[model samples]
Target: MIKYEIPETLKEHENIIKRTFRYSNEIIFKCEETKPWESKLGGCPYLKNIEEYPVDEEGEPMLFLAQINLSDLEKLDDLPQKGLLQFFVVNDDMFGLESPIVVKYIEDYEENEAQLIKENPYEDNEGYKQSLPFSNNGKMYFETREMPISSSLELFETLFKDELSEEEYEKLSRDCYSCNSRVGGYPYFVQHDCLGFDDEDFLLLQLDIDDECGIMFGDSGNCVFSIPKDALKNKDFSKVIYDWQCC
Candidate 1:
């Protein structure tokens, strides 16, 4: 695990951003604006105006409009740190696993035990050979009580609207998702579904403690931090990241 002290200045700003984006935050405005043809699928929607309306492959104007709330990004400037980090899983063929593994939030122990064995056959063992424990893939979920900042713009009359090309739209969508999942100057923990592993397979994770720390797994839900274990002797809210596997 890794540990770092949260500067007092950053703590207040962090709290402000959390409270502003909270479920109870008041919506002060609602307006509509055309997503410029160039802005279609882009990550930062607030930075540019729609130049042309969107259209289909046949060159017809597409009438797909999103209803968004405007107050979500009103106080964005107050956020301490703002940027998106792409969090994705890469399959390791040497270990034999698929990409983008699903991470689940474990709620029931008894029910999950049977389901784990069914989903992961590798956990089965013969006499004298111990069975590997199932990975706790479903133990984390976020409650999006309110709309995100980027999606707050409501539908408006468009002077220049054109359909976005398929390739352009796909790239924009990916970038949009990446930005939405970004960690905003706060400490958060995200649990990923474990990949298939042999006795020696392990994870090589790069943690950004200044932004977020820690990953958890299993029934005990042991949290691994980036800070060394010995360094946690005395610290308050010491951010850390860690990794662990069953023996």
Candidate 2:
């Protein structure tokens, strides 16, 4: 599940936009304290006893794709100007499948770069896929958390809010952090010029599982912090942008 803060600036935006997708997948978001329910449609037998499953105290229920059709973007016009939006996907069809939330910042300098190469290391690395035990065949499902017009203002606040001192910017250049586990940042251009991005990019928080690094995973969910190449000169966060997927 994803959760994030809505900055005060975004509450005043007057317009929002959306692009149609090749397919519409059903999905749902549930509170961390809620339980999963069995599908009344009678599909996916593995979830027959889903009601008896133990609750996850660490977070919330596994949000799978819902059987019921849902608008890819919901309540865009009514989001609170300043509150937490915790959203997740519930799809029983892909229940128990491998999924990882990936967060990455697109460099404006890479504007001319092929989108696929920037997003996935299809040729250079098979390491991510080596660990997977099952083949999804050729089918994949994706759901995007639609951004409202207010996002532009929120992003502006995130990128320029507090002027960073040279020393502080140096530290920020070394790593990225988010107070909310489920939120992340991305560049402003992604909202405008980047078409077909919905199928490839989504804001997600991540937890690195390796123990050697001492970094706490899931302490911050898949939320993105949008940074541009110029910000690199004065920013204190790390240069690494994560590309994550859970299927």
Candidate 3:
């Protein structure tokens, strides 16, 4: 969930806001110094062999963006109980949208570090190109919570007016503290560029522009992945919609 408390202006309608937006279960990845095989934001990926490393459609090796060890997170009903979910993006300006975005699931945990991909994938120490974003190789510690995520301003305003008359809702819409690296929450984007998104879709991941983590999108922006509720419950990453934007 968002770290900031609810705005004082909307405190009166707290219950109403909560009632309107369904609380989405979320896992916040705390990026910190960690080991190689642990769930991490940027680091050497977890793979059985060299062949398992991902590459884009043009045969260029993809950069490892993140690896989420599902077993490291709380046992949420929608998430896998155990395994690793890894994300790889092309080393280009297109990121994963035009190029291929590889989302892989390792069902069984490989405990031994020696058995995993020990050698760094990138030839030099450069994880990303000058175009691709950069974040430190920090370990991911999961902080799970329920969040009342709003999709768009239009939907929020409509719901707000319904709960209370326009006169009653005398204040501006409260600020949303959503631009953080998180998972399984309703996505809030700087640009409403969600092309294939609909009501059926929920946020699978939001790798936001984290200044603290040194992660940037294009120009001070973030990316989000939306997936059908059933697709997430079934642990199906094939149909994931990946979109990133900048301010």
* Candidate with best lDDT: 3
RMSD (Cα, Å) for all candidates, in order, is 24.2, 18.2, 3.3
Off by over 4 Å in 1: 1-118, 126-141, 145-247
**Candidates arranged by lDDT, highest first:** 3, 2, 1
**8-53 per-residue lDDT for model 3 (tens digits):** 6567878866654534434444556555557777767776687888
* Model 2 collision count: 37
Please name the candidate that would achieve the greatest TM-score relative to the true structure.
3
**Residue by residue across 1-247, what tens digits does model 1's lDDT show?**
1122223433433342233232212211112222211111111112112332232344432221111222222232322122211111121221112222211111112323222222222112231012111111111112222321121111100100123345543332232221112112111122331322111211112121111212212333321112222322222113223333311
TM-score of 3: 0.81
Question: Candidate 1: lDDT over CA atoms?
Answer: 0.22
* lDDT (Cα, 0-100) at 82 in candidate 1: 23
Candidate 1 vs candidate 3, TM-score winner: 3
Which portions of model 2 show Cα errors greater than 4 Å? 1-165, 174-202, 210-242, 245-247
Candidate 2 structure quality by residue, lDDT tens digits, 77-98: 2211222112122222332223
What's the lDDT for all of these models? 0.22, 0.25, 0.65
